[model samples]
Target: MLLETGSVVAVEPDGLWVETIQRSTCGSCAAQKGCGQSLLAKLTGHTSYLWVSLAGRSADDYHIGDEIQLGVPEEVVANGSLFVYFLPLLTLLAATVAAHYGIGREGVTALAAIAGLLAGGALVRWRAYTTRHDSRLQPVLVDDRQVVQLVG
Candidate 1:
């Protein structure tokens, strides 16, 4: 479980809306000064919110501004990343190849590749919408009360 701490922003019937600051690894990376990601991170600074379901806990237990930890599965993140990046490129390449061999025209091939890319994007969106309510994809609340901190 990958843990992240967030503050409760809003209370929902079944869950709490938590706001987390997005932190980039650019500071630790060797390409910190050269990469466009570092620049992009600076432009898009922090504060992303997520709606986390409270498995069996009542909403009354938590108050607005309460801090809690959330855990997301490593496999889920890895699989999602691959699906988003690879699917589009795969479709683009497949379409280009099919067009090159079938129609044998440069302009038509380019258009087909574009269409394929669009299709891949639409598929990604559809998958996200379909899985919006999936329990496996949702992040689990990591209860901090269960932990026993040692004081010497």
Candidate 2:
């Protein structure tokens, strides 16, 4: 199980609302100088992510402003992150390589590669966004006593 700490933002009769902060890798990236990728990321506000999850037990088990530990399975986190971060790049790489080798014309190969890259990137991003947006927190375990923390 994966564990994160979060504070209860809201408490309902049936469940508690927890906000989890999102982190970014841009600050750690070595190349940020006039880089299109970096600029795009900043423009899109991809630097941080916020999510909410349920305490998994009873809504009455927690209260507003209470800090609790939320648990998610490792596989779920891993798969979700990987699909978002890697799948599209992998698809583009595969496509570009396949096109380069399969086509004899340079113009065709370049166009195909660019098209594959854009399409693959879009597909991956859409999938990632959908998954993240639709994801609900399923509690593996909850600790009301623990302080609110973002575990991911």
Candidate 3:
């Protein structure tokens, strides 16, 4: 599970709305100083925040301003990334190959590739809509206890 710390911003009947700072991974890269990603991050500023749903916990158990930990399964993240990045490319390749070998026309191959890419996108959208409520993909409230303070 991947865990992240966030502050509860709102308490809903089914979940808590948590706010987390959006940090860029570019800072850790060796070439960040000259990378376009680093430049873009600088222009965008670091103050951008992500609001996420922390579900599977009672609203009574948490409150606004409370610090909490949220967790998501590693498998869910891996699968989602693969689906988003690879599906369209695979479809385009398959369509181009079929068109080239079956029809032997460059124009037909280009049109088929375009159609395949669109189909892949539509499939992704449909799958996302169907699985939006899947419990395994949703982030869960891992811990809500505040850090202990030391007194001098």
Of the candidates shown, which would achieve the greatest lDDT relative to the real structure? 1
Which is superior by TM-score, 1 or 2? 1
Instruction: Kindly list the per-residue Cα lDDT of model 2 for residues 1-152, writing each as its tens digit.
Output: 88776667777654556654322444665666665656766688643223344434456666766666678888778876787667667777777788878886778777777787788779877865666545453444355444345568
The per-candidate count of clashes, in order, stands at: 0, 5, 0
Best by TM-score: 1
Stretches of candidate 3 off by over 4 Å are 23-56, 144-152
Using lDDT as the yardstick, the better of models 1 and 3 is: 1
Give the clashing residue pairs of candidate 3, or none: none
Whichever of 2 and 3 has more TM-score, that candidate is 3
TM values, all candidates? 0.78, 0.55, 0.68
Model 1 scores a TM of 0.78
Kindly report which residue pairs in candidate 1 clash with one another: none
When 2 and 3 are scored with lDDT, the better candidate is 3
